[model samples]
Target: MKRIFILGAIFTLALNWSCGNKKTTEPPVVKPPVVSKPPEAFAGFLTVLTNDASRKIEIYDPTIENWNAAEAKKWSWAPTTALGFVTADINTFGGGTDFKLRKVPVWNNAEYAALTDNGFAAIIEYPSGKRKWSKRLSGNLHSAELLPNGNIAIAASDGGWVRLYASSQGPDQEYYAEYPLISAHAVLWDPKTNVLWVTGQHAITKAHIITALAVGGTDAVPELTEIDSWRTTIPSAWGHEVSAYYGNDNLLWVTSNGGEYVYNKTTKTFSPAPTAGLTFVKGIANQPSGQIVLTRPDYNKNPRPAMNCGLNDWSTSTVDFYSANGQLDGSRVVNGACFYKVKLLNSSYQ
Candidate 1:
């Protein structure tokens, strides 16, 4: 007919150009699926353990309140030379600021460790934060604890030393079994019973570790055995400085300057927290949000200080944050900043 209609219109234009150049494997480029950024439950950096402040162990940021010093540089202390403060996830360090508060300087890490009232101890060695070991004991060595097995427990508020190191100690060493408490000053570590609760100056000891520490050579010298001990009914003249906590029913709160009480270790009884009116206490903690935190001694509060837990006027208070039924939610007025104790370290990983 017209060359068979021009060969059927060139076979329908070569069958529509071979189905548009036939590369039909086009359903395999589906990529809008990459969403990993969610690990921060709690831990926003708050471990400013000072005691006789020259800035001993600091890394603060209670959500920052514009405490002006260039905004306190995101949260002070990328510096060290401590003589106090420890506790909060085995003594917290690292991750204080991407905001110029910088990071990594917990003595340069090795799962880093810290203690300094001049008697030193900075164990380390995790994903290689390196110092893997060190100890100098004898100076004021105020506090430390990390022994659910990976040994290292010191407390030397001036030679009442209750030492025990064996995470393979050997760098600047001096800890390999040393516990016979005569007067410790707070060194608590009882994750329910890997025991060790020293606090003497009237007495309170309950150690336990008859040999258990060694995961890499040089394994010996780990023996602390003081099943249980207690004596502080306080008022031994009030120059007291205490700290004790393992609460929630079996209770056992103990803090002093004679205030902060509650000890019912199954009724060996002495209770008083119907809402303590804070006058002076030195350090007691417990808060996975159930709150009950203390650290008192408010910078001569006649006027030039701050912290007023609603001031029923207990002399102006230093650090209180109650509410395990005892009300009072917040307060922090460290005017003489030697704030000696705090470790709210579940910082949501900042």
Candidate 2:
């Protein structure tokens, strides 16, 4: 009876060992990688260049569902309203930063550089609408860009020149140098490459700022040197607007008389943007969240007769918004006010 019990115990131990050694067929589980959520649409304010008798730079909060000039005009800057300021038609809106004062420039405290079609350019403190500097530029002024060295660059379309001013010298300082660019309409300073990108009649040119060395080692003045240029693809091309595609630094959002395009820096090629085929896009910019904001004439709606909508009454009272996927999501309209160019108020050139 003892021998039989011992054999039974050995059999039980073998069975337990076999069960423990068995291999399972199930695969190992994997947790998916964490992805951050995209920012909400129209999260911040949009700075718009409104062309009316006032010729004002208006700020509209996109977060407001129903925004209008009367109710939503919380902040605005009219050159006509400022003391001893030239009442020029507000043309371009570009973001600027005073790195010494603010780490992150917001809509209220940031410095903005703007130009008028009638040869007026100025650097104004936003919200306060105080003019830090003002100059009456020559030719048909289209755009002004603030440089890293506290200088300002102007693109005069009719004169075909890109002018550089030594702004640190003082307000109303004359330009020290000018670069030849036919029908120059837009100027943008690239912080990454330390180059200025200018859009001309038929090409996009890249220029380097050449600062002269003074006798005492002080920087005398800066000049622009053309590095290279890419001829645009549009037939009878007339470059009107150019802005950095914040969604991709390698790409630029360019608008011409024919249509809109995304210029790929890597490939040096031009491709139609999602908003391509849209007409009269005076301004186009990408938000940090990858959405696009733009201004163009809505011909379907007639301009208000009381206001001067400018040249053929082309200016519209609407600012259009597009999703990252190139879909038209929404629009904000300000009655009685014609908006020409729309810019994201935040200082995010990326």
Q: For every model shown, what is its TM-score relative to the native structure?
A: 0.28, 0.71
What would the per-residue lDDT of candidate 2 be over residues 1-350, giving only the tens digit for each residue?
Answer: 00011123222321211110122222112121122343233765455555543456566677665775355556666554443365442332221111111111333435554444445667665446666567765676667766545566777766777877776566667746777777676777666656677776433433211111111111237766766444333321455667778767888777654456777766766777775545345678777677778775543222323333443233566776777766776766666666656666655554
Clashes of each: 12, 0
Candidate 2, residue 62: the lDDT equals 72
Question: Candidate 1 at 298: error in angstroms?
Answer: 26
Candidate 2 is scored at a TM of 0.71
Model 2 scores a C-alpha lDDT of 0.53
lDDT against the true structure, per candidate, is: 0.39, 0.53
Tens-place lDDT digits, model 1, residues 258-302: 334555544455566534533234455556555565554332132
lDDT of 1: 0.39
